[model samples]
Target: MGIENILSVAPDLVDEVARLKSIEECKILKEKIFMNQLTKAEQEVFALAIDGHSVSEIQGIPHKEEFTIKNQKRSILKKLNTPSMTEAVQQFQNLHQEPSQKLIRTS
Candidate 1:
């Protein structure tokens, strides 16, 4: 069946699907931003970090020296304007989150 047919049968499902698609699109855009802003090595380091890998674990990879990985992580933080890796990960997570899902802080 076509989307129109599906929408007619379940409007709420259509909305939810659209919302999910939008979230995916936003994530893609954010990823593209990272690609544009970071070098290939930095991207690799950042990806490992995002996957919960420690610097030592990243350094354990073949041909990936400890100093190189640490430098790449520092570059990532500088490029992202984040003070630490944890905050950089949080920023990435926030960028991937849907608008409605983000918490609204108030005084």
Candidate 2:
């Protein structure tokens, strides 16, 4: 329907639609910010860290030396704005939380 027709039929719906559009825009901005903050290598390191891999194990991977892996870990922490490994893992996990999983809690 045209804007004028929609406005005449339901003015309140226009406001709601605008609000939902704003929310979706914010989500897209946040995702872009997160992606821009991390380098490709840092993202790989972050994923491995989330998997509970040790530094040595990461170093064992092709093209990843100990120094490079350690540097990537530091960069990941910096990009995620987290101080510790635990917090970094938690932050990454939180970003990927499923809608259903968000409703569940463990005591």
Candidate 3:
């Protein structure tokens, strides 16, 4: 039987399954990030950029020079194999959204 059939027998299983799936997805995403060879600093920069932070804003957050932040962003793009910050953000969003979309569709 499929998960939906099993879920109908025990409605309480829904939340637990969703939680476990979320954890598993997080682990997989971390593995992907590690495989991309980004330094911790570069990862932070990538996240900030994904959140729509500008180079100047990212610089202010890290108290770094604008040039340094720009370089970091460029490095993040290279490591993630993305052409630009916008594409990188889209890629990240797509990665994270897949599990949620699956859950929604199943529900």
* TM-score of each prediction: 0.69, 0.53, 0.60
Position 30, candidate 2: lDDT: 53
lDDT of 3 by residue, 5-36 (tens): 88687756767697778767775765576536
Better of 1 and 2 by TM-score: 1
| Ranking of models by lDDT | 1, 3, 2
Tell me how candidate 1 scores on lDDT: 0.78
Global lDDT of each model?
Answer: 0.78, 0.70, 0.74
lDDT of 2 at 49: 75
In TM-score terms, candidate 3 sits at: 0.60
Q: Candidate 1: which stretches are off by over 4 Å? A: 1-20, 98-107
In model 1, how large is the Cα lDDT of residue 99?
A: 68
Best by TM-score: 1
Return the clash pairs for model 1, or none.
Answer: none
Model 2 lDDT vs. the true structure? 0.70
Residue 5, candidate 2: alpha-carbon lDDT: 87
Q: In model 2, how large is the Cα lDDT of residue 1?
A: 83
Q: Write the per-residue lDDT of candidate 2 for residues 1-107, one digit (tens) a residue.
A: 89888768696777667665665565565555666688888878767877898767778889778888888888888877889767877865665452332333322
Clashing pairs in 2: none
Query: Which portions of model 2 show Cα errors greater than 4 Å?
Result: 1-33, 96-107
Query: RMSDs, each prediction?
Result: 6.2, 8.7, 6.7
